[model samples]
Each structure stands twice: as structure tokens, then as C-alpha cells.
Target: MSKKGKIISLNDFKENRKLTDPDGNPFTGVCVDYYDYEDEQKEYETRYKDGKENGLCTRWYENGQKEYETRYKDGKENGLCT
Candidate 1:
């Protein structure tokens, strides 16, 4: 789906663990976060639904190695997280 609203910085979203549009609606999409050091690999990518994690969450190391992957349902960890 299209990005819901004004783009929010990764840090800001992390602090609250919730994302909202300018109108205060829950955000739904892949939230991609990157390392401070410039790199082609992203730090993480998480799928969100209604402002909470609802699908796969994947992370990587700065060297571009995949760190781990976790699944979530309604913001709570579920299924395999490896």
C-alpha cells in the first residue's frame, strides 16, 4: 500500500513503537530503518498494521549480514523468531 502520511524518521517511530500519519491515524507499511553509518544494507525492515507490528521483522548487521528475523501478531512476538 502507499505510504500513509508524512514521512517520519526511524528514530521517532522507534521511540514510541507506533507510527501515525499527520492526522493521527495508524501507519501500515514496511518501516525501514538504516544504520547511522552510510551503507547499502538497511538495519531493519518491519511490517506494521494499525501502528503495531503484524508481520515479518527482519534485521541485518552493518556488514550487510542478516542478523535475524521475527514474526509478530498485533505487536506481540509470534511463531518463529530466528
Candidate 2:
């Protein structure tokens, strides 16, 4: 794994230092992933945050066909498909 800066402390997770995004968006919080760590070829990936799938998600069929494509919001299904 690649190393980033030191964790420092929770104080770094604050907006008091202009640390947030331009939209004043604060912490993105915890995120989880369904990873294909063993495959040499790319495969479907699903990511979750706030206990929901909240980003670009993809799914594939065993026949090597892509089965799902979509976006998410706050971890819920949102837009686009196939």
C-alpha cells in the first residue's frame, strides 16, 4: 500500500483550516469496496459509504458482459444504466 501523510489527529478533519472542499463539503466519512484484488483483468467494482453504495458502480456477467452501470447519491441508487 502507498503511504500518505501522518494521520496526525481528528483536528485535521475540520473545516476550521479551510480544509474542506470549495463547496464547503466536509468529511466524506467511511467508505467500503467490493474489490477484485486477485484478477489480472478488470472487473466490476462497487463502493459504499455511509452504509450505502454512493458512487459509480459496475457489475459484470460471467460471460464477460457488463450488466450494470449507474451512479449513486448518499449511498442510494440514482442515474443511468446498461
Candidate 3:
């Protein structure tokens, strides 16, 4: 399968052509958040490719307060911080 924009599972995101860092490692960031749903892991993690954030990710409290904001590049975080 091409596996592009397929919306695979979290494991898939971590195992597939996962974003890497400057050292060719996995690019990563943590967005801490909260939610009322049963799912406790409400935060979003910023992803990256070659040390750049290039994907959709955000952090908001379960009550709906934006905890943090970020940018991405080709599926990685590369610009700004909030």
C-alpha cells in the first residue's frame, strides 16, 4: 500500500516513514492537554521530518484551552512556538 494520507494508527505513525531528527532519528515534541472523554491521552504530539515539524498537531486542555501551538515542515515542527 502507498500508505500516504491513510490516517493509520498511532503505532503506524511511529513505525512508518516516521519523522526523523537532525541525527536521522525520530523527530518529536509533546503537546500536553486534557479532555473529558474516556481517552486520557488528550494531548497532541508534534511530528517532524529531518528535525522539522511538518504535520497537524495541537494541544488543548480538556476544557478547551489551547495549551500550546506549533508549526511543521513536511510533517514536522519547524517554526514558532506558542
Candidate 4:
């Protein structure tokens, strides 16, 4: 997937510093997190804006098949999910 947001310093995020999107829209918070089970080869990832899931979230099975995918807007599911 194409990267959608600007990169900011970790320190800024840690300090709860406000940020702006590339287009200069303000964001009160942002975060991305990943979870992996190395032994099982499973993984999951999600992104957040303003303290809520506002982007793609995905999961993968241990066998390498995509387990699921969903999109979010303001922490609520907003598009196709599979």
C-alpha cells in the first residue's frame, strides 16, 4: 500500500505533540503499531489518527494467507472488509 501520512519524530509523538498531514491538516495524535508472532509467522498491524483507528488495519495467518482486512474512519469501520 502507498504510504499515506507524513513521518514525524518519535519524540514528538511520545510527547503528544500535535502534527499535520502532508496537506497541512492538523492531527492531535497519531500512532502505528505492529504485532508479530515470530514462531507462528503471524502478524497484525494498524494505524491511528487522533487516538483512533483511521486507516487500514490488517492481519495475516501463520500460513501466510491474509486473515482479514478492514478500513476505518474515526475509529469506526467505513469500507469493505474481508
Candidate 5:
């Protein structure tokens, strides 16, 4: 049988608690959030695995400058962050 999966928006992914991966495991992917209202710029972006942060996580300032960057392993900081 061929593997199948569905791509959903970040909001849907977060709002739905029963989403799963093609393999029947918890879904995993990248999520980017933006500031609300007038400042509609990207606020941050992060990687997720099994519903938890498991890779690179980056945040930005409202002005669009990179505020910080870090790596995560199973939702925990695992490497240098700057």
C-alpha cells in the first residue's frame, strides 16, 4: 500500500488534537506564527516532531530582524543557541 498524508495549516494542526502522520504516528512539521493585528510580520518559526519541538527554532523581531536561533531535541534545548 502507498503511504498517504495530509498537509494542514499551522492553525488547524494546533487546533486539532487528533492529527496523525502517514505512518499513524503523531504529525510533525514546521510552524510559523505571525504577530496579531497591525504588526502582521512573522513572529517565529519552529520545527516539530511528534507534536513537539524537535529541531531548529528561530524567532524574529517585529522589525524583521532575527532575534534568536536555537536547536531542539525532543522539545528540549540540545545545542548552542544564539
Candidate 6:
């Protein structure tokens, strides 16, 4: 999969500090998190729009299986999540 934007730690995403890209702009695009400290396995792939969750968000198992998927709009769930 192609990463669309910045790759930040889950802690940084949760801390929500400024939430800007490397150039000090509002973050837009995908923010990926890993299951391991070394970034070996993907934990989640969430799409963002102006710093809000605004698209299909997916979680994965450490074994590379998808756990669930949820759609969001303006940071809120917009439809059936599965």
C-alpha cells in the first residue's frame, strides 16, 4: 500500500499536538500506525482531512488480518462500521 502522508506514532496522534505536517501545515491524508516499535507490522490505517478522521478507517491484527473497518465523516462515524 502507498502511504499518502505523514507517518506518526499513535501517541503523537493521540496527543494531538498541533497536528501539522512536516512543513507546519494542517495534516491531510493517511496516518498509519504500526504494531511494533520497529514499524514491522501495521496496526491501523486512518484517513484524515484537515486533522479529522474523514474516511474509511481500518484496524488490523498483528498477523496481517483485518480486524474491522469504519467510515467517518468530519471525525464522526458516518455509516455502518464493520
lDDT of 3 by residue, 1-82 (tens): 0123222222236534454433444545432233543565465555444434466567776566678877766654567878
Highest lDDT: give the candidate number.
Answer: 1
Please say which candidate is ahead in TM-score: 2 or 4.
Answer: 4
* Candidate 6 residue-wise lDDT, 1-82, digit = tens: 2255344432255635324565556667887777884766889988888767889999999988999999988778899989
lDDT of the candidates, in the order given: 0.76, 0.46, 0.49, 0.58, 0.68, 0.72
Stretches > 4 Å off in candidate 1: 1-5, 9-16, 36-39
- Tens-place lDDT per residue, model 2, 1-82, is 1013222112242433212223444334332222343552345655444334467877776555777788877655687776
Please write out the lDDT profile of model 4 over residues 10-81, one tens digit for every residue.
225453543355444544443433344345354766666764567888887656688999998876788999
Point to the candidate with the largest TM-score.
1
Which structure is stronger by TM-score: 2 or 5?
5
Lowest summed-lDDT stretch of 10 residues in model 3? Answer: 1-10
Off by over 4 Å in 3: 1-7, 12-56
TM-score of 5: 0.63
- The better candidate by lDDT, 2 or 6, is 6
Worst 10 residues of 1 by lDDT: 1-10
Scored against the true structure, residue 39 in model 1 reaches a CA lDDT of: 51
- The alpha-carbon RMSD values of the candidates against the true structure, listed in the order shown, are 4.0, 9.7, 8.7, 7.6, 7.1, 4.2
Between candidates 3 and 5, the lDDT winner: 5
TM-score of 2: 0.44
In terms of lDDT, the poorest run of 10 residues in model 2 is: 1-10
User: Which regions of candidate 2 fall more than 4 Å away from where they truly are?
Assistant: 1-43
Cα-based TM-score, every candidate: 0.75, 0.44, 0.40, 0.50, 0.63, 0.69
